[model samples]
Target: MQRPNVVLIMTDQQRWDTLGCYGNEVIQTPNLDWLASEGTVFDSAYSPSPSCIPARACLLTGMDPWNTGILGMGRGGERHMGIGFEHTLPGELAKAGYHTQGVGKMHFYPQRSLNGFHHTVLDESGREEDPRFTSDYKQWFERNKTGEYGMTDHGIGWNSWMARPYHAPEFLHPTNWTVNESLKFLKQRDPSKPFFLKTSFARPHSPYDALPYFFELYMQKNLPKAQVGEWAAMHDVPKDASSTDAWRGVRSDEDIRQARAGYYGSINHIDHQIGRLLSYLKGSGLMNNTVVIFTSDHGDMLGDHHLWRKTYAYEGSAHIPLIVKLPKSMGRTVERTDAPVLLQDIMPTVMEAVGLDIPQTVDGKSVIGAMKGRSAEARDFIHGEHSTCYSEEQEMQYVTDGRVKYIWFPRIGTEQLFDLSSDPYELTDLAQRPEHREQLAAWRQRLISVLEPRSAGMTDGDRLVSQAGKPFVKSPHYAERLARFPLPF
Candidate 1:
């Protein structure tokens, strides 16, 4: 019984339904579909937080954002929370006698020097917006540099909607560079021992710059139209929102169609890259011994409900794709499991699959049993949180049980409840309905019970004090600053 090698491949802002195996006929994700067919695909998987940094922290630490105090972005939050830089998944794997390496966007500070990995390739020199890194992209056009083209600035959000041209060489895209680096690492691996490699692709997140071939593939396909609802019109979205959704202001039938075309094209591009990586793995003789897990940090709104990005608790943003390929002992060939899982579960699951002891402090439960075809009670409930990002807004939390979802907006004192079974789009709010009051109370208590234990030890001094007196941020500039400097680590 030798320990298995682990390869955790993650993409930024990918939706669960984007893959061909997930019932999406327009996007061709042959590699991901193959992984799903050869492994266990958890139909319901979610991120603990909808935002990038917080969700990533949870993934690497196997703890909730609140538990790790990584509620926001930047070094400030990580430092404030006193989360030692050494407590990540790779660090734990390294301690357990496994070689750990990472490539692409891990999204942590000190972007270089193994956050936990024994080796990291294609590391960005600084934040994407840093002037030194600007030359990496050609269409970053300084005048149009809304600050979203690179990782350094959070001013402009990156998404398919803001399809900027790339002037730099094709290799500058993080996904391209990450896969190239990962292949290089694979070539140098020691076959006698187990290894843990995290290959993160930073495309499909935004500035949707794909090679012309990818875009061309989808340009000829007929994509689905955007989903919009009345409630979406009430909130003030950012300017880049219009870039992704041509109908943001015009709402013409044709505009929605065009947006969908471009969005699907971006996803196709991601799938092609994934296909390339998987082919290399199989050709290199690592496919049989390696356990490959493919998933995403969070999801994109992609014009769902008129919202263009993540951070919202809507299914379009919170739900993600999760596929795990275990060795023969773990079973094989597309057994669809109805297990309720979270992104945080990935850390523990990988450790368990590799025969390592699960850390007691980690909150996620290993799904090894489920992967082995054993029946078990699915998770009782999945929780998610969204702190202010690019906005000085009140904090929000969500809890769901696959059928119903409850969202708590503390700042506006408004709560939203959605019957996911009936309304998958989350277009209607049932909070004020008298018949649903009891259900609301039950869900609220469930949320409180789950959240109370995590907040029990917090002191008044540790509260998110900076957000107490500020008005809810509505400006994109303020939102950009918030993205660069998030709060209450």
Candidate 2:
């Protein structure tokens, strides 16, 4: 059997329920919906650490947060630690004779670390922390500026929830550029070798600036209102509500609609670009021998539970969409699996698809068996966490098995339970109810056992300990990676 070319398309901060296939009827995602119809959708996929750097680290190394040395956001999560990873997805695949190329936001530190891809074209928006850093997308924008306004001229903060139409022409949007570059790569790739192309997009995360047509397309529809839970009243009081980038707080009905409109528009724009990529693949006769997977790093909270961004264990932030389309020659029909999976699984799954060795160092399991309609060894549950980020009370640890979830806030010792089978939006908290105490206690024990072996002392074999005020702890591997940085003169 010949190895298949692999394409991994990922988005930033995109939620699970934004696609038409996910029961979101108002959104326009025909391309993704078509792909889902022809592929297997992992219904319960999640980010093990629901943040940018940590989640990408898991995808890169096929390791969970503890093994990847990235437990949480780590106060901006911009630490230069690419040197810490001894094995990466592209690096391992490259060794197995695949020509790897990455296009779009990698979010890896050192700004331009290839992590073993033969080449990479980046779009690291506005992150010029490396003094001499500039993205390929920005460089192209500078040369092709149609007017005086730059990409950021929309005046939306990079992480802001503000919504509006993009100020520039639709062709100049970064989302369009990302797919254009990928198409160019497909046209010019080394045809002699199988290719591993990771096309990552950096939108639907914030500064929700979509093309004017797309922005209005959603605005005219009756979008679903943000669902706030009964237990979220404490956070409903406007804290930093005046800021465009407020992480927590309630917003007016009009404000939430504008934000959702922009967000849905951005996703629709990406979906249309993906349609272009799919068309090219079909036209070029590559569809039969290519393995294409689509997913996101994590999900945006999107005002759910009065939370505006990620790091929460709620379904809005932790759950992500995962669609895997196997080569047409494989003879597999469209399927949906309820098995709980994580972002790390992508590594071994891709390895299995291309007949490469699944590196022994990786903690992620391959889901190929399940994808093929066979009973694969499945996990009972997945544990996820993030250190203090937007606020001290935001530090959370959660365990879920698709049907239910339990979140524990270490900073305030608060617990939340949701029966996902009945309430997927998590509108009600069951942690305090007497009828659900037994279930909550069982879930709590599961979390305790997960944290007991960690070096952070988050749990003491018998119970979860409070971790308030203490500084964020870095895994030894991450600390060593950060230590390798050269000192300033």
Candidate 3:
């Protein structure tokens, strides 16, 4: 059998519930929902790290973020750059004769760093910090639109409740440009070898600036109200908090409504753009030879629990929608699995799908068995973490097996446990309950195994630890390779 081409579609900060197939009743996502219906939808997919650079690092490298050194965004001078993984998914595929092209947010340092893709056209929205590389989308906007209007002219803060319709033509938006360039690569790619295309979208992350029609559609409709639990008071913002403050709680009910509407509007717009790529594939008769996968780097909270961004262990941050569609020639049908899988698994799964070798360096197990309708579980649980990005309190680690989740905040010595099967929204904290003490103890032991080896000192072999240990990061790729791509600022 000829190897299949691979198309991985990713969105930034998009929640798992934003697609129709994922039980999203309100969002307009016909095209994505169709893909889910045709493919195996892994219901418990999660990002190893619920942040941009780190989560993306796991996806590209198929290694844990602890080894990758992108523990968080690496912003604000404490760390200027991220670890450069030598054995990357695209690099491996490219080595194996697949022509790989990445479009949209490849959020690596030096911005121009190919990471692994043979070619990448970037639309890393609003990141001008990297003086080394000029954004292709920015230049295109200048070329076509005469740079008359910027994407952020509507005045919505990067992470705020401010909602507005896109001020310019829909074609000029970065979301469309991302797919536009990806389609261009598809159209021009060599036919002698199967290609790997990453059609990555940087929207729905924020500047929640949807196209006018999308905004109007959501603004006129009534969407689900934000979920606020009794335990969420800690995240509540004072009414006096700045409107543009990304970390402060959204104090107004009306403001949260606008944020949710804008977020949904962006998702719908992205879905519409995805339909364009699907249209092209089917029209060109190339759909028979390709496998399409869809996911996101992480998810937005959208006012849930009085929070707005990702990085928490909540479902909105950790859980991601994952769909994989095999070509009809492959004899696979629409199957769904609840086995927990991580973003890193995509690398091994794609390698397996195309009949390439799964490198031993890749820690993620292939979910091909799950995709093939095999009942065996892919993983018992998934472990993930994020460092303090914008907030000192955001540093945390989590482990979950889909039925339950445990989150530990290293900074505050806090623990939270949730029975996801019973409380999907995570309204109650089970960590303090006497009935769940044994269960919580079991999870903490699991966390000890997961973190103690990292030399984090957060846990001993048998219990949680307050302070201890030397750095255990032995990978030369972390600090050694990081020097090559110094922080651009």
Higher-ranked by lDDT: 2 or 3:
2
Q: Tell me, by TM-score, which candidate is best.
A: 2
Candidate 3 lDDT score at position 403: 88
lDDT value for model 3: 0.81
In candidate 1, which residue ranges exceed 4 Å CA deviation? 74-86, 123-160, 164-173, 236-259, 332-334, 373-375, 392-394, 455-489
What lDDT tens digits, residue by residue, belong to model 1 across residues 126-242?
344332442222322333444446443323244335543343445555566667778777778776667888988776776555556665556567766666655666544556345
lDDT, candidate 3, 198-280, per-residue tens: 99898898888888888889988889887776688888657524657465574577877777778899999899899999999
What candidate 2 gets wrong by more than 4 Å, as runs, is 76-81, 483-489
Candidate 1, after superposition: displacement of residue 86 in Å? 5.7
TM, every model = 0.82, 0.97, 0.94
Q: lDDT for each of the candidates? A: 0.67, 0.87, 0.81
Error of 1 at 321 (Å): 0.6
Q: Number of clashes in every candidate structure?
A: 16, 0, 0
Worst 10 residues of 2 by lDDT: 75-84
